[model samples]
Target: MSSKGSHSGWTRRRLLGRSVLAGAAVAAPSIVKGAQPTFAQTLSISALGKAKIDWQQFKGEDITVAVIPAGYFNNLIDVAGAFEDLSGVKVRFEKIPPGQIRQKILLDLSSKTGTYATHAADPMYYPLYVTNKWVEPLDAYLNDPKISDPGWFDYDDILEGWRSACSIEGKPYGIPFDGEATVQVYRKDVYEKAGIKPAQTLEQFVANAAKVHDPANRLWGAALRGFRGAGQNMYIYPSIFRAFGGEWFDPNKKLVVTTEPAVKALEWYVNLLRNYAPPGVENWNWPDIADAFGQGTVAVYIDAHSSAGVINDPQKSKVIGKIGYARWPRGPAGKRVTSIWNWSFPVNAALSERKKKATWLFIQWA
Candidate 1:
């Protein structure tokens, strides 16, 4: 299908295209109808630019990167060999568990050991990293003509929200590799049977969940992350809090999580899980919730957009064509708020200039 037609309408291709790794499962057609470019036809222009990137610019440079075992790691592994061959840059990946990768990177940065030239970063920690001068500012390399292919790199193609998310104090410290936002994905067939549309408001969301819930048949109304920790709670609760106009801290940085809006949002979040989620949901994290959704046991699932890619994959999901995606529901305060989750690549501030430039080239390739 033509790129214009593929994106202008809500075809399965378009739906999956929004997915993080959807390209791996779906085969691209060799030819496209009409006067439009096929995937291969567009590659010459889209891959980099008319002016190809000089991959060998930093040949024979070796750099280490620290990454969590997540989607980005899988993507990197898929093309790391090619990058090494073309650029003569020996890439070393230090795989760390998701929960510990942040701390590990921070320690490496603070110690100034330069153990890792570049590390995967979560935008949530941008403030902390910027405050400590742990990450290198990427503007110089990004704009340098000798180092980067501005036309091919197509920095503007990145979504503005993602760009802003990786920036601190108007300076970009990281390059967003993958981005996700909280969204509602539901069983469209179930909603159709119930004669209901996707929820637009928080109250309607709960009502829809209750209406479609069928425990006798092993189906639950919703699946969500409830594991207690910064990892789980921090990911799921902020949307509820923001929707209800709850702020975490005052202008002076005084704690405000105990305020009325905050308490109400928390109460609502707890009640939904307690009443509508599957049993043992209190221990569920992103993986558990995703598994439940993929198994066709949940009517509604709210989490990162990346999970939708998995749940929509025919090989991994029971509800491959039965899903519908929507933005997070609005709250009583007439606000719909969602949190952005991104994994970015940032150079270590401690790396030597040559290493930094080489790392930047790899980042661009990635």
Candidate 2:
């Protein structure tokens, strides 16, 4: 089946052609159908241009990268093998659990430790990295004609409101990778039964959720992360704060999580748990949520797009062909907020310039 959305023009073959061609003209197909490009494959011509790296020059070095477990980019052995085949450098990859990634990074960098030379991280750690000076700055690498593409990695694709999130003061600290945002997922069949369209407001969202929740049929109204640890607390509870016009920190940048809005957001999340979610949901992480949605147990999901590929995987999802997605609901603020990151390969400052260059080359291939 075509992954092409209604609005996109290019398809898988055309996207591949564009990637290979990079710039030269192509003869348009007469009856192109059912093959629009995947979002990841649709790189702007400028991005393809900027991704060029001279792998032949970086021949005799071993490059290692530290990545989070289940990290999609890191797990691409085909890309790594391609890089190794093109360049003689052997790739040493390591996956650290999310709970221990920070400490391990700190130990490696602070001690100028062995073999651990590069990092791939979510930008949420940017604040900590800057305060600790954990990773090297990429300004030199980005400015070097061999590496950075200013136009392709422009502020527009990064989104304006999120610019400050990844930047420290004014310097770009980290590149964004994947992010979690709650897109609306509802049972279109159930909505049709109840005579309601997809919702736009908080009240509407709640009402729709309640309507579709049929316990006799073992269907749940919603599925969300509420594991009570950093992952759940950070992703699921924070949106409620925004819904109530609350900010995590004050204008002066002090932690003010105790405010009324913050409390209300927590309350809303707790209520979601009590009312809409399936039993035993508070213990779920990413897998459980994906499974719940795939099994037809969930009527709604307010979670990350990181699981987009999994939801559509035919082997695992019962609702693979049935799901419909929309943006998160609006609140009084009239603006939407979602998390984003630049999960890029970051070289260590302490490494020699040659090694750093090789690291960037591997990153380009990655």
On TM-score, the leading prediction is 1
Residue-by-residue lDDT tens digits, candidate 1, 264-301: 99988999999999999998888778778889899997
Residue 284, model 1: Cα distance from true site in angstroms: 2.6
Q: What is the lDDT of candidate 2?
A: 0.61
TM-score of each: 0.82, 0.76
Name the lDDT value of residue 219 in candidate 1: 94
Give the lDDT of residue 283 in candidate 2. 81
Clashing pairs in 1: 48-152
* Model 2: ten consecutive residues of lowest lDDT: 1-10
The residue-by-residue lDDT of candidate 2 on 1-366, one tens digit each, is 011232122232244333433222222222111123334344522234333455567788877777665425433431344455556667776666555665777677777764666776656676676777766666666677665444333323445445556677777655444334567776666677778777676666777878888878989888778676555446655666787778878889998977877776677678877898889988886668877887888887777776765666666677766777777777556655544434545567667778877876665444
The residue ranges of model 2 lying beyond 4 angstroms of the native Cα positions read: 1-53, 68-71, 96-107, 146-164, 177-181, 229-231, 332-334
